[model samples]
Target: MANFTLKVTRLGFSLLQSVSPRIAGKAAFRLFCMTPSSAPKGEKAKVAHAAGIAKLAGAERFTLALQGGGKAYAYRLNGGAIGRRARYLVTHGWGSSSVYMADIIETLAATGAEVIAVDFPGHGGAKGRALHMGMAVKAIAAAERRFGAFDAAIGHSFGGAALMVAAAGMLPSVPVVLPEKLVLIGSPSEMHWLFKDFGKMIGLRRAAQQALEKEVHRITGRRLEEFDASAAAGVIKRPVMIVHAEDDKEVSADHARRYAAAGESVQLHWANGFGHRRIVAAPPVLETITEFLTGDDSVREAEIVPLFDLPARRMSL
Candidate 1:
């Protein structure tokens, strides 16, 4: 059914491209930003279970009023310590909700740090059918304002890119101050790559693609290329850990390399076996992330290592 729907969508866009490429491009861009109604792969049950994991871990579930008209669902997990510890923010990828990051949030909480996980608008418990980077940035800002400033943050895929863009204070709608430490897992280097990839997937023509870019510019008040995570990392003088799997089919490893090259304090950690989605929950990846956030910063940024003790060659920039 999905394949058939995709085919029909492609045909409709193709016809629209023939008549008015600008209209087709605008339509295609909207399709690109559409959020999933249910969890990815139709794992609605699993997502539900993950959502309850936070509550089971004694997290205080709350809803944050966003700057816009929507509200974001968030889970605040207290650290296992008595006094105040480092606070952390965890965000999930596109087509996913904050429930998916429940494990990571719990793990951070166990480390005696307050952990807050927020679902972007149009995802998780948030009500909407559309979402964009600007919406995500505002969600993060709203979360920060409701809760307190976080000492560190971790994000996967689209969430990571949004975190970077927000931290860089690029978007005018939500001027945000993100955590000093960040970990981006399987995230794209630039928004332009995502725009191009979506266009290719939908079989958009050149004119449609140009129109899509123009529409994005009109919405964000900046070119799509301007929303580069590498550029965000370059300007922020904070420690950033870029974790990517060599075999990740969704996002290329080159994005991780670009981040490492652009940021002076950025470290790249390669993982094996764990693909784009699984890397968020991979034990080694989580362990390395914990170490980066809580442990001493003794690891050298130049020398890259495999997060797992697999028989993989060391990757370097």
Candidate 2:
């Protein structure tokens, strides 16, 4: 039934494209920005459990008022160390919340760097049904204003792209201070690829595709191709660590290569076995990231570590 509904909807959109590409494009854009609702009982229980654990661990919770009349919920886990603290921020990908990044956040915090994890709009406790790259940038800006500058930031998938776009100063309206270092995992390298992929999935005509591109520019103040993470990496002169799995089925490992090719400051690490999502929680990956964020500059340029040689542990996911 769901597949049939989707097919019928696509056919209707195709027919609408024949009649008016502008209208079809507008509708397609809305659908594209719609955030998935992952509020099943098990998912809710998991989020609740994580929230409970966070509170038990003495994590500080706060909210930031967005510029566009919405709220962003964030978690601040104080570093375990007693002296000066390094500030770190973590953002999750599409359809995921800060809760999903709990492992990474906890690992960074354990390294004695104060970690802040944000739940993007329409995910976690944030309110809204629609989200886009521009909105994600604004959320990051809001977090920065609430909690000064970050020494480093780690983002996975969509969140990684948002961090690059914001740090690169691609969105003029929302200026952001680039983090001293960045860690991107399984993230898309270009925004236009997403648009083209979506177009192909929905069978959008060229006219509708063009119209959708115009709508993106009108809202984000940049063309779809302009939100390129590889280009953004060039603009950001800071160190970047890209960790990707060769077996990642969602985002190609080629995206990681593009980031490394952007500049000398970017390092690429290819982990075996772990796919798109599990890579975030893998123990070896965590160890490497912790070292990169807290270790010396020399560690930033180290070659990829062979995952099979490392001791395997059960994943939390």
Candidate 3:
């Protein structure tokens, strides 16, 4: 992890040399669009995405690709229009689009609940130089407009972080009538840690990491230290469900604990085999998430170490 941080740190101003100023401004933007896939990004992502696409049927189709949250770009996957009660709002992580969350959307739809999954700004179809708290809510509102309102909220990685922020943080708070139950998958309890870790994975050094922090402060207008998910977790009044894989190589299971520690209302579930993406589709996970959406709190606490039956490597830049 230290080495990864060093790489990103190494990339600081000197790394910027490889790209133009126009590109550096957009580098973070491009990074956000990369999504979380185990395969090599770029061509491999396109291929893997094709496989994910091939699996879709019925209302599971990822359609209406467009910019959302008033950002430069965003994508929306409709789980076939809104139903009367308890809609499901799905959001994806950094560099990802609405496509990957299709299974969860479909599973939610199968339950007769409306599902609207959106790709946040700087990812998928959403357009923005970068993702901000303001834009995240915009994507949430965009889904609400069409799907009526979500009774539950689900997100992965960065999306998971955004889910908490959208539910508890953000301006105006999007009217309480939207999503009441929140689900975060593989997202850290602290934003600063998340960014710091992300920088490490991409080869950032301490100094470079500081530069990254500076950039974060400059762009988002908030101190990186202040963006603590645990603090944010405190403000969320509704039930927050946290799901993490024991074998997850990226975000550690400790992150899940952080969320649970933040508030009494938070619930943590440690899954056995399903990694980050597949967890959203696993029937057992689906059962757990669906139950949570229905306001069931049957999940019991267990040793988080058991989750890592298989050790996986962390994210590679």
Candidate 4:
């Protein structure tokens, strides 16, 4: 009862954080960082601590060339406490770096999974490259070459779109290279929609949106018909989980609905207002993720973890 009260207090305070977007983002981030951790269940804590220590030791930052294209880059975080591992790859979205995905990586790692989280072409250490889905597909392939076949793939937003293309048979082995499951966080059903929405956020006129769409075509070679998630979703054979925030002002809940409607093996879970990026590290988000990756497919919306691990959340910094 005390623990529940503390969580509620923390969340209520979190809600009272500054209203300015920038300040609010920073405050929420700080809250996630400075918040005291609840003692993990004995086994869970051991797993997490062991994984953190080993991750510190086994961490390898490396680069690989995309077969015929340029080089791709990523970091590998191995739970040093374990020998072999079930593999998982996580991809990050625009405006955010791979640093945000570390929380999820550590949680899964503590469970004895080998984890690789990649920065997109223009994000994280992947700067100096253009943002294109094909480039992201190559990055996933390059990571596979270095890390071996993965048991799962979880991508947030734009990164999810990249993996979606890879799952749709753009990679060398197509669905074979795809892990047993694909998880998307606040992911979009259409790349064009994302571009237009982003345009509006930054004050782009309709004319500008149309012009940008032309550039998207020139760069990605994806026609308007091919822009929909349905194009690639049909080829994905593995189970998929869509995680989104119910009150997100950025990516709407409709994105999840569209994905669930079009995907062959798909699950959707809605959460509190963690928005587009914060949702990445939120506890409810991770629970849905852990459930899917571990094959506990009976994940009802209520099963989502309401509280987060503060230490893992701080690792983002």
Per-residue lDDT of model 3, residues 106-177, tens digit only: 677677765666766556544444555446655666556555666788888777776665666443435333
Off by over 4 Å in 2: 40-57, 79-83, 299-317
Q: Please tell me which predicted candidate would have the highest lDDT against the true structure.
A: 2
Which residue pairs show backbone clashes in model 4? none
The list of candidate 3 runs beyond 4 A from truth reads: 1-12, 15-48, 54-83, 127-134, 170-178, 197-211, 298-317
Model 2 Cα shift for residue 20 (angstroms): 1.5
- Residue-level lDDT of model 1, residues 1-317, one tens digit each, is 27999899889988999999999998987887788774545576576556656444576777888775777778777745577788898888888776677667767877878888888878877778888887788888988898778899898998898889889988877767679899998888887867787788788989999999998788877778789889789788888899888777788878888998985688888876686776776777778888899887657443334455654431100
- For model 2, how does the per-residue alpha-carbon lDDT over 206-312 read when each residue is reduced to its tens digit? 99989988889988888888888887897789999998877787888788889989988888877767877777778888988988888865644444554556422
Q: Where's the lowest-lDDT run of ten residues in candidate 3?
A: 60-69
lDDT of 4 by residue, 167-205 (tens): 775434323257778888877777655554444443334
TM-score on alpha carbons, each prediction: 0.89, 0.89, 0.72, 0.69
- Residue ranges of candidate 1 with Cα displaced over 4 Å: 39-57, 79-83, 301-317
Clash counts for the predictions, in order: 0, 0, 29, 0
Error of 1 at 304 (Å): 9.2
By lDDT, is 2 or 3 better?
Answer: 2
Give me candidate 3's TM-score against the actual structure: 0.72
